[model samples]
Target chain A: MKSSVRNQFEGTIKAIVRGEAVSEIDVETAAGIMSSIITTRSMEEMGLKVGDKVTAAVKATAVFVEKA
Target chain B: MKSSVRNQFEGTIKAIVRGEAVSEIDVETAAGIMSSIITTRSMEEMGLKVGDKVTAAVKATAVFVEKA
Candidate 1:
């Protein structure tokens, strides 16, 4: 699908930590391993598995930066 | 603020695009320039300016990955 998210981490699925409601998809990207949380239903529907190629996209509006 | 967001990109502010209600903050990180859209009030309260150090944090749930 097309995405407007500027922060796109293209990588392979490192792991999938499934919870009752949500699941964490750990992707191995050049930036390092990043985690994405999605619903278990979506996870199953998407058929995402370890070693699968994916692009982790974060919307600009959802991005929050703190003073460091 | 103490955040539970795992995704953090530490960088210096490259620019701030101000709008009526929200503003876009662009930070230069190792990954490249990342943009964060935040409310103008938060931007003003944080006193973020160009060259200021900040860490862009994205919540795990806010992250969405697509099959590639």
Candidate 2:
């Protein structure tokens, strides 16, 4: 919500899985479960844990729009 | 919203600019204007035009969550 990223979703942490260098976090937002990978160090520094409410931010450049 | 992208927004086409290979599109969504660059070929194939209603989708992997 505070990031420069315009697209933000408020969600609860559903799961957390640790990898070699990065951690996979699954957030259960109203739309769906949004998954992302971040550095384990950042995850620890942020003190993020399962069930914690978080805001997932996606840069506008990373978003693709389409029509059907 | 119809694609595999979990993060999607329904919005009206705000602006579209064509480039040599990719095109920049701006969609005015409820939150904000989502901007993206896509292949001009795909843009033409989709017949996307300004003022059309479209959906913006973001890959989960491209999303990042943080707390403040």
Candidate 3:
């Protein structure tokens, strides 16, 4: 599928922290560990698990940056 | 302030695409252009604009990854 997101990193799942509503997924990439917060439903839908290979697609808008 | 998010990249603002409520921000990092979608209020509060230096903090749950 076509995406407007510019950063796409191929990575392996390192960990998953499941919450009541949201789930935090850690993807180990060459750059580093990329983290993501998604709904538990989406997590289940994706069937994400540790050691799985996945692509982390980040849209420009979802990134929040603060000055250093 | 401390954060649970793991991925933090120092970058410069490249562009900002504003919407009615959410805004898309493009940050130029060494890895590439990191993009984020945030509320307009947050954008205004940060005073985010092109050329500004900021750190992109991404939580594991906020990142969505698909198997490739």
Candidate 4:
């Protein structure tokens, strides 16, 4: 689906940490490792596994850039 | 503070949409505009305004990467 949210990075799954409700996923991008949290159900629905190619999409609102 | 969360982007604030509880923030990076949703209180605490430089940090658990 089309979205206003930007910052999409194509990467490979580096790791997955399953929790009770949320699952932590790490994507290795050229820039660095992009981390994400999603519901375990979504993780199961996606059938995500290590070495899989995925795109990390972040909404501008969810991004917090620190001043430097 | 140190964090395990990765995918930090250095960028400038593009826009901010203040809502009753949550606020939408947009950061312009070389890659694109990274959108983020933060609490209005956090926004105020950060004293975030347009044209400010900030780093967008995303926890691996909070990020969702879709397989393609």
Q: What is the TM-score of chain A in candidate 1?
A: 0.85
lDDT by residue (tens digit), candidate 2, A31-50: 56767788888889899999
What digit string (tens of lDDT, one per residue) describes model 3 on residues B1-68? 88866788887889999988998888887667788888989889888899998887675545677886
State which candidate, 1 or 3, has the greater DockQ: 1
Q: Which candidate is the best by DockQ?
A: 1
What value does the lDDT take at residue B12 in candidate 4? Answer: 86
Docking class of 4: medium
**Per-residue lDDT of model 1, residues B1-68, tens digit only:** 56677788788999999999999999887767778999999999999899999988788888987884
TM-scores vs. true structure, each candidate:
0.84, 0.67, 0.64, 0.66
TM-score of 1: 0.84
Best lDDT among the predictions, by candidate number: 1
Instruction: List CA RMSD, all candidates.
Output: 2.1, 3.8, 3.9, 3.6
Q: lDDT by residue for model 3 over A1-68, one digit each (tens)?
A: 79866778888999999998988888887667788888889889888999999888766545567776
Off by over 4 Å in 2: A1-3, A66-68, B1-35, B49-55
lDDT of 1 by residue, A1-68 (tens): 56567888688999999999999999887666678999999899999999999988888989887885
lDDT of 4 by residue, A3-52 (tens): 66566878899999998898888888765778888898998999999999
